[model samples]
Target: MDRQKYTIALLGGTGAEGSGIALRLARAGHRVIIGSRDADKAARACSELAGLAPGAALSHDANPEAAAAAQIVIMTVPHAGQQKTVQEVREQLAGKILVDATVPLVPPKVARVQLPEGGSAVAAVQRLLGDAVRVVSAFQNVSAHHLRDLAHVPDCDVLVCGDDPEARETVVGLAADMGLRAWHAGAIANSAATEALTSLLIAMNMRYKVPGGTGIRITGLEETAEARRT
Candidate 1:
């Protein structure tokens, strides 16, 4: 993959997660398009991301146009809005990768899992996009708070899953560029498990007041000294 030769579009780019991803991608030298339902909001976000990475070559547009302009589209909209966002840009997403960052957090009692139909956001996107778009799931458990810092983001692991290997690799590249450890967690069906972990993490966060929250690390998966000796 050419480090300086890709264009990424972030749908719902006005939000913290979306804008942060846009900012980091822009800093990485990709042509980034900040997309929103409101054209003005997208424009403002592009300006903000530009400040984060000077001469980042970011642009702004309504959802459809933004998706059309970029080779990859990222759906960072809230769960409630995720389906609609995908539908709105579906026509423009044919043969492109759609990175889904939506978590099903239904207001008030968000600590409880509230998964959508099809079991996960990526599944919902795959359904909506049919075979036209390659849906890849990622960033569900990631904290929006980290992306807000343009200077640096907390060390985090991202589990990227999709049926299409190309799509999964594309998202993994983006994750790596953002200073994250990304693992290919099998197909899009596995996304249901990954998304559920976030709600469980939220409950842990409330109970322990752990500011940064909990992240899963596979024990013994790392080649520790004890394992190496065996």
Candidate 2:
């Protein structure tokens, strides 16, 4: 299958994860719109990214406008702000894929896994967005710092979870485009496992002092046809 190109709206694109992913997406030849509550901040981020990758298609807009313009919307906001950002763009997100990268890590005790009432951050987003929008959860285990440093390939596997099979495949392809291996980790509800794994990784980072960042990779499947093809 030919990789489907998408105009992606990155909500909270002024932040670390959002900007890092935006940079990768832009470099991969996808049109990226940095979306933020502050349009100026989004524009500034876009400018900085443009400098990093000379001729990439990068732009900015307020959350609503960006969401409206894009075919795929990625939510990278903190857990506290995820709902508000999602609500802001709710109307514009219908019939689109919304990749939820929000992990529920209550600060100070961020090392201790803390899942929301709905099981995971993505679950809450799915509830808020309803059936009109397809929600795929991923990137919780990735290090934003690693993503920003395009020179180094991240040694991590992205666990993509979504109720919709096609949506999951789309996000997996996006992760692959960024040079990261991704696996379909079943339905959106399974996102809780991946989200909780972030805290475990944080704990491991501090406990063992892994410099850049620690990541997870699935093993024992090297002989599979899918793995061989990749």
TM-score of each: 0.89, 0.97
Best by lDDT: 2
- lDDT digits (tens) for residues 107-194 of candidate 2: 9899999898878889878887789999999998999989999998999999999999999989989998888888989999999999
lDDT of each: 0.80, 0.91
Write model 1 residue lDDT over 115-220, tens digit each, in one string: 7767886787787678878999998877777766755555567888999987787787888777666777888988998888889989998999978666665454
- For model 1, the superposed segments whose C-alpha errors exceed 4 Å read 1-4, 218-230
Kindly provide the TM-score of model 1 when superposed on the true structure, using C-alpha atoms.
0.89
Give each prediction's root-mean-square deviation over alpha carbons.
Answer: 3.8, 1.2
Best by TM-score: 2
Worst 10 residues of 2 by lDDT: 221-230
